[model samples]
Target: MDWQTTKKDFKRYLEFERNLSGNSVHAYLNDVRKLEVYCEDLNLEIEKLTAQHIQHFLLWINEFALSPFTQARLLSGLKTFFNFLQIEYDLTANPCELIETPRLTRKMPSVLNIEEIDSLINAIDLSKPEGMRNKAIIEVLYGCGLRVSELINLKISNLFLDVEFIKVEGKGNKERLIPVGQQAIKYLKIYMDDIRVHQSIKSGKEDFVFLNRRGSPLSRVMVFIIVKDLAQKIGLQKEISPHTFRHSFASHLVEGGADLRAVQDMLGHESITTTEIYTHIDKDYLQSVITQFHPRS
Candidate 1:
């Protein structure tokens, strides 16, 4: 089959059957496209490609000096594509079955200390209409440990502020209730009661907890720009993003002796192993845990 039709089929498979996000589906398709390009340049039909062709494509891409993490991601996508071909198209043999992902050196994400977080928040221009909104955004981002997409899509109906919990819609549209802190609750209330209520919300946008000046839902890029602008304003240059608050939240909670499972639940991580990074980030906390709970101690 031609790569074009195969790609369309793969897209549908990922969207409907696998239930991946749009960004995730595009990423997997992009990886497949790289292999398609290599095959096209050498005039090799994709259906006839074997493991050697796949290997050759990997080697060719390696010339671009991609990071190890990126290399691993690309390999993962290729493996998924061939598996889809085998299952859906009934291919006799999967080409990328035996390929190994490149070993990646995991780097610890940068965490914002409480003081740095306070400084960033305090620097907001409260005189402006969006100032309280920005404060509330930072509070929820750090307090709830939410992803940017979740923050942007946060609905008023899903919020249980009086009960101190907010239902977050995470990856794959999975919903989880995260406990909100008192500070987040206070600022979120102010933004909603005072600021957002005054806005001329457009039709169908009223339920969104956060809205722009035009009364529409905020975009992910707008959130990034907001965080970046705040970072620049405070002169804190640690390469922060909306996710830095998430990492900071987990790290601080781990340091404060919160249960790992509880933190994982709050962050909506599917695997406990994904939440294990907090243990590494807080070395003293790790030591304390060992000392307090370990049989060897």
Candidate 2:
């Protein structure tokens, strides 16, 4: 198949079969474009591309100093593309099968301490019309460790604050119930009663929990900007955003001796291994504890 036609089919497969959103579909397509560029540089047609070609392209990307995260995503896209080809076009062989994805090192996420979180939250001016809704946004982001996409798509119908749980549709359209903290429920109630109740919500966004100034749904970028502005207002030196709160939420739970499996369920992590990355053990703290308590000493 020609690159253009194959790409078009890939889009349909991603949307219909994979059920990915527009942005996610575009991201996968962008990864394919990288392969197309590599093929062009080598003067090879799309059909002539082999597993070895894909491997070389990956090596070239690493040689060009692409970050491991980006490399990993591109590799994932390639794998998906080849899988689709095998299923649809009777192309039995997959190129990405033997391509080893780069190992991603888990870095500890930047998190605000309790005092810093309070300062950031208090910095929001409640005098504005969107103030109450913004308050709810941050409260839920930190309180539930929700992804930005999940936060924006949160529906009023899904909130079960009385039971301390909220239903979230995460990656691969998988639904999971996450516990909602009490403080978040308090802010949510206030926002729903005061600001969200009075707004003349647009037709399509009526069920959406967080609304823009025009009574519509808030975009993911808008949420990022809100977090950034709050960080600046509080003079937080560490770079912070909405997801930082989530990382902090998971990290804090792990650090406080919460059960790893329970934390995994709360964070909606697909695997226990993924949740294990959030367990940040301090070497120096361990040494101090041992020095103070060991009977041998």
Residue range with the least summed lDDT across 10 consecutive positions in model 2: 279-288
Best candidate (score: TM-score): 1
lDDT, candidate 2, equals: 0.86
lDDT, each prediction: 0.92, 0.86
Candidate 2 lDDT, 1-297, residue by residue in tens: 788989999999999899887889999999999888888888887656688888889988788888999899999998999889888877768878887888988676677777888888899999997777788888899889899999999998999988999998887687889999988999999999987888898987899888887888899999999999998998889998889988778877777888999988888787998877665543334665899999885
Error of model 1, residue 124, in angstroms: 1.6
lDDT of 1 at 9: 97
User: TM-scores, in order shown?
Assistant: 0.92, 0.86
Clashing pairs in 1: none
lDDT of 1 at 188: 98
lDDT of 1 by residue, 85-175 (tens): 8888888788888878888766888999999999999989999999999999999999999999999999999999989999988997789
Number of the top lDDT candidate: 1
